[model samples]
Target: MWLGSEFCARHILRHCDTLAGLPAFWTREQHGEEASTWLLFTHKYDYLKHLADRYRSRAEPMTRTFSITETAITTSPPRERVLLLLAVALMESFGIQVNLCLDPAYRQLEGFVLDRQRCAIIANWVDIDAVWHVDVNTNKPDLQRYADALDHAQARSAIAAKTPTGRLTALAGLLDLDWQWLTHRCGELAAYGSAGIADPHSRLLSTAGVDRACGYVATVATHNG
Candidate 1:
């Protein structure tokens, strides 16, 4: 049950009275439903938007091109990691139980907001990607395929790590300069998962699919300004 920012915002405005009160309400509400996920997402977006505004105010002016690379993302003083950690902290402040999953490829780290009361996975950061539901009711064939591919890739990389030659090959593949290939493959998978669900909300969600949709908006504003 993936939801876009607008849908989340609208739902929150209709159902929730205050952002601070959301966690309690969501905890008491039913899990694994689209409405519940939307409420959670609404809070997530609100927190991210506030964080982006704070970052924009404190950010130093610079003209250098912002590059997104595995090394740039996972190494010490990583920008994405820092921002995501901040997001996790903020969610915790609101009483939301969130978890982070670091991809084996180290390309990206995903955050999942859990329904602690039900011990269920509710919503995840599906930024610029398809939102996945790990519940029994929803069909996630495309997500499963993508997960299988990722597992296979990780398994191969693990085997390749035993030898110097194999290590070099694995490193080359991981650090492959062609990020377009990776992004394209992810877009294809998202498209497949979202097939036949092309409503306006879905389109907005896809466009804003990165970990924090607000962060992407903030980045563009910073660059353009």
Candidate 2:
């Protein structure tokens, strides 16, 4: 629904040793504010269940919604995959809704997203470091293709087509691309997602150059912009 502060599942598992140690963004002093933490999961499946029960109660929204990006289910080890399935079940039991992010990738997590409230469908392309990167940038036409393919698959699961096995109701993932690209891309893709598409820690505003977090962009763009 609304974009507040978002933290990826793996990052939380990596940085916070205890639930109480969660960033103040999600665990602030004020209790009356309307806020929520978007947990964009990519992996580290084992710890997700350990968190599902603890987070909902502490966050602003008691029954919070969590999000997960396209994960490598088909390629991951069997043990991790099983853990992920179990984690999804646990979240469901806790009354927290989970949404699938990214432009329909045919990950076959239909059981996880079917009829669930849609969350953020972010398409950000970020470079955390020289060796590590995240790319989800996409266009409206691309998303339509994904939706059409998914429809075909459902129609032919009888000779239809398929990609990720579900229809994509997109929102936004702004500040993902460089200024030159985003200025144009954001307008074209806004109808698909949100208008601003910003998350303070992860996808904050920038012009497009280089820094420690985002690798490098066109010369006209800079880190502070």
The most accurate candidate by lDDT is 1
The segments of candidate 2 whose C-alpha lies over 4 angstroms from its true place after superposition are: 1-78, 94-120, 123-139, 149-225
Query: In the order shown, what is each candidate's alpha-carbon RMSD?
Result: 16.2, 20.2
Error of 1 at 36 (Å): 22
lDDT, candidate 1, at 178: 31
- C-alpha lDDT of residue 198 in model 1: 39
Span of 10 residues, lowest total lDDT, candidate 1? 22-31
- List where candidate 1 sits over 4 angstroms from the true fold: 1-3, 8-72, 75-79, 104-225
**Tens digit of per-residue lDDT, candidate 1, span 1-225:** 334434333443342222221121111111113222322344445644443443344333111001123333345232333333223323333323332112344233222221112221233323336543222112255334334433444343321333322332233233332323433433454444423343235322332223222232222222211
lDDT of 2 at 65: 22
Name the lDDT value of residue 176 in candidate 1. Answer: 38
